[model samples]
Target: MKKYRAVVIDGKKLIRRGIAVMTLAVVAALGVLDIKIAAPKINVMPDSIGQSAVAESVPVIGAVSGTAEKLKSSAIAVVKKVVSFVLTFDPFDLHTAVAEELPLIKAVGYGYLARTANQSIAAYNPQNVDTGGGTAEPATPGTGQYPITEVDSGQGKALGKEKSKILIRNETDFGINIDEMLSSPLKFDMKGEEPKVLIVHTHTTECYSPEGASVYSADKSDRSLNADENMTAVGKAVKRVFEKKGIKVIHDATVHDNPSFNGSYENSRKTVEKYKAKYPGIAVVLDLHRDAFIYDDGSKAKFVTEIDGKKTAQLMLVVGTNGGGLDHPNWRENMKLALKLQNHISKKYPSLMRGVNLRKERFNGHVALGSMIIEVGSSGNTLSEAVRGAELAAAEISDFLNTLK
Candidate 1:
């Protein structure tokens, strides 16, 4: 009898070891696949303190990496749908479906089932999912595609080499006011030690795509809130340009979108207000953000154009109006500044500026008449492109602001 018990114990031990080995093998396979979620990174600049440095690239994973990521995402979506359907039945409301301890058992069973389902779903779906662009809006030319309302067709210097016109589609229902904003020649007097321009980022974590990398992040949501590595790096580039031009700028490298995505605008507003209070000479408050343009066919849209023999990402000027139930009366002033800068950029860089975008949100533009949001580039662009774009923008903006009288 003792010999028989020992044999049974040995058999049980062998089964346990086999199960452990299988579990380890599955984990090893997943590690090899290196599946990533499909979140694209957005770019933005932050605070300053140096010359614009060239960006370095990291090698991207093989094609299998992306495929595994998509497969896992689809399986989760399917399981979520099934779970939602089961929850709608509300079995708890029916006494027929309940027993003495069935409620507790059902809760425990559902928890375990979800955990098991998540673990068992293999990252190998045969179906092809459009993971690239997803449902991102395309960079469709014409005014309706962007958030803008051209109030006035400002004077242009008769189009430089290969003149670019601001494309606008007047079919939208947005109100347009053609106010003569150019009252006097814009000029700025060199003030005391106070900063001339204040730069801040609401989405301080937005980062550009790395060169030679398939995606910016291994996870689907491609964003890094690192102030030194992401948007703040771009901001520093801009600050370097301004400093080179002898324009004093205050680049606030605060990460507003850190713990929460919401209330970023509010946080940035406080930052702007604080700086404005400290530096009364701050003439312009720039909220720097990077734009994202993804094509409808799940492909990233490229907004790069050759400027001065360097591949530079296009820059967009976003000016907000008080149309969206916001009490911003000085939006026209901001628009005027935007128009002037747009005209200057179009003339200087030709195709570098993607025209000025007018939006309904205040975007904290009420902070100052010179306040505006500058979108450097999209996720499809590299850090080098964005940094170069910011430098070019800073030069143009410095020239324009200096002429403010």
Candidate 2:
């Protein structure tokens, strides 16, 4: 039998090398690594105020082995970018490591930033520019199910008639690229014709984003990310898709309506119980949340989206593989459902996703066999994108559910 290999690295340190129990891969801010099985790089370097940004963070120096050079370099570079992301770089010196040692410390300089690093409000993209203070390589311009518009604004003005326009104010990190994400392993693994799958979305009370994520709380109202709309929109989307195929759908979107504190899932369970009574055929559940590590770019806003080429949305998803609560016998079953969805999407749509994030904590994944919650987008994510993602999810999962046994 052909064996698979799972390489584990912590920040910059190489730790383990073994095929994971499951082919499921997790995504995070630091170079697209997973959360749980991930190994943090041990900072053998002296700690100081300079490397303050990563004071608590493990420096992702490289990957596990030499054979994985490209992977390792990419990972380390990503970590360095996040830690070194500062608002005020001297344009020549970008090294923020406080009186510290950098194993491969390269030249540090200034890059365009709408926000600074000291604030801790959000994170920056790992990809940086070249020596000329420019973003360097050509970034894959934003694309969507819509069209793109040009703007003639300040920066656009600064361009001296350079064709430039904004994609509106409120935009999403990664618009709901269900078709795109479905092709990546980070989404629901759909196998053939979608079955009558029922997914339940759970909400978290303190849904916040990591400092350097694509989505951040520009306004306080975005503190919770796009939790509510994620579930509702996708729920409805799935209903529409499934219903057309003679499948029944029910969503307890009000599971944690206006919940107080962080126990939204607890309240959500109450509503879920009610759902159990109404839709006895329910099979899948998802708890939605944004990530804490990844951030976005403010330099001309590359991560922004345009609907129909106009202003639109992008989305991110996180899934908890944690036992959820007390070890429920049905826990594995829930995972099976999650795996099924993830695999399906990975094969169908590859670019639409950031990646599947297998988390450590459980929101309420043990209630049923097909129960799993998903985090759509963060506050930085546009309301429109969040809505779009849910709908895309409904469409993709609706197709996958019909394939379930």
Candidate 3:
């Protein structure tokens, strides 16, 4: 009986291999025949209007495992290019060939063509595709999702262009005591037993490019508020990090800058007020956002660094002042918190942060002493890098908060 079972399994394996060979033969035949084809023209142009300019180049170094991946990717890309090039040759139209060719071959070829056409149509639909940076499947709206597990904590060495520049400007109503903030001890008393961190985004629609991705769809922008796509996804990363560190956090994934870009701050302010009223113990309010700085040449400033052999986006701390007659006196206190956290992050993960920016306008910093806007990365940084920056920021923040009395 055991021998009989082995014989049966061998027979099945032979049959499966035969089918695979037959499928390959059919595909080869289709390619040789060139039933139908379309010639596509390629064109490249400079951006006339000012848009976020992508970095001309970046240093992409991977570990030993990355070599294998690069080879496999290269082979696959070459095959795809060859196939695409062949499909452009119209040796014979499908209908014409079917009408004038061998009866059996024609029928089989027509059936294959029909099936391929249907599959192509379904796959090409814009609404069905998931263009997010990572392999995690997108979550259905209204349902919470935490798909990312491992953080990219690789310590990347500084390349020539990878270092982010720190710009200091005079944009404050009063003199900033940077020396005092740097010297101040990290100490905070727990206000209440509930969650003390409130994570929010004024421009919830701000998004980053997918890692190693180049294509963009007509219907969707790289900057979206989709839960698993943009800054909301980054917020989710931060929330998970804080939760893991035993820090209670509430991430508001509400889209305030949707449908229109105006008055987003007003909408986000309401969200902060509502959350503050509910959770009086909230001591830290981080308005997480990604920056988009287009250079005069229309290229975006790339703030990238390699950590532990992984490429991660560097972070920028933007502490606002109560200038422009905004009536925000507690701005100095907020700056103190920002400077302290910045110092901590710089000490621990030096490559993970750019310098701190002290902006002039009050960007909803009056909500809390610990409130400040953090730009994880710019438009040039991929979503993967942005999320890694968020994770590192969460770690530094948790360390600072735990030190408080």
Candidate 4:
């Protein structure tokens, strides 16, 4: 009225302020309503807001309550969306996605996948290790030497001392009559051209000293993955002798002692069973291995002898029995065959035979009538010497086996 410049009422600004005030009122109403719902019996309202004031605000509160319900619904929908996204995400897919852009991750991812695949395959085709059936025990200082009580007139004698006496290192309570066993006829009937002998390696990777090296590093294992350098090579030498003698033999180069040393006998047992199932006529199963002996002073023992002026490693025939509590009814028959072979081999080269080791463990010997573990040489010998020893032993063994019927 005093003619003050007519306060220009901006209508748009007034409308915006009105909307902001409405939103604040709605927020305050929701807070009060939440408190009322949480504490139904408590009076949390301010003293200034008497019964009449609350009655006046009832319509406004009711209008905003609907809006609050809509907002709660929207929030629940957003939570569901987040949960759905999380639940569907795959970590492997994520790894693949990230690996696509990163070169190092890509290489690592591929390697991981390959390793997992291999492990899965291995799980299905398990190669379990078991030492209960006997294993390659460490060599002692006087392994090949004849004991005072067990030595017979010709048994355990040197080449010039005795010709064909059977020496046995009996490690069991069971008594073995060498003469009786040698005289006993072999029970196996060798007929037809079917596979008569199955040669396998329980400790397939057992190796010997390198050529020209008398001593080896103690830290380095006396084992090799190369079939040409390990017991497989010795098996091949034996196979060759059998083949030359017109005897049908199966030389199974299956590696039983790789990726794991335990359960080697178990693994070879499976291999033997497979071959035996295929060739029911299989008579003899030879588990070829190299002996290992580390003395208290850490020096390895090498059981070597001279054969026709050639340095030859000595061989040992191991026969297993049921003393270990496993059922092996045919163990005695296996022992009989071993004794016959030992007698035969010793006659040709007396020093070549290191005596038959009779043990308690069945050693898969129950699989056949003529199953035995043949240790070609100790870790102290060379590959060449072991091969020669196996050839010499197998030649005589095959000859004797050929005569059995």
Each prediction's whole-model lDDT (CA): 0.57, 0.38, 0.59, 0.67
Tens-place lDDT per residue, model 2, 1-405, is 111112224543211111111111211343465324334355433444535444335434323211244445556555444333431222123354321222112212233221111121112313211011111111111332211111212112233342221111211222233343333332233333333244554433223223334422222222332544334554555466657755555544554534332345556666666666665555555544432211122112212234344432333333333322234454445544554565554344332333343333344555566666554543344445545554555567667765543
Better of 2 and 3 by TM-score: 3
By lDDT, the best candidate is 4
Cα-lDDT of candidate 4: 0.67
| TM-scores of all predicted structures | 0.57, 0.43, 0.57, 0.63
Candidate 2 achieves a global lDDT of 0.38
Q: Write the per-residue lDDT of candidate 1 for residues 28-111, one digit (tens) a residue.
A: 565567666654332212322111121112112221133446455444444434433444322223442341123222322332
Quote the positional error of residue 51 for candidate 2 in Å: 40
Q: Judge candidate 3 at residue 186 and give its lDDT.
A: 37
What is the C-alpha RMSD, rounded to one decimal, of candidate 1? 24.1
Model 4, poorest ten-residue lDDT window? 113-122
Better of 3 and 4 by TM-score: 4
Which regions in candidate 2 have their CA more than 4 angstroms from the true location?
A: 1-201, 204-219, 223-234, 255-259, 288-317, 321-325
Q: Candidate 3 vs. truth: CA RMSD?
A: 21.7
- Between candidates 3 and 4, name the one with more favorable lDDT: 4
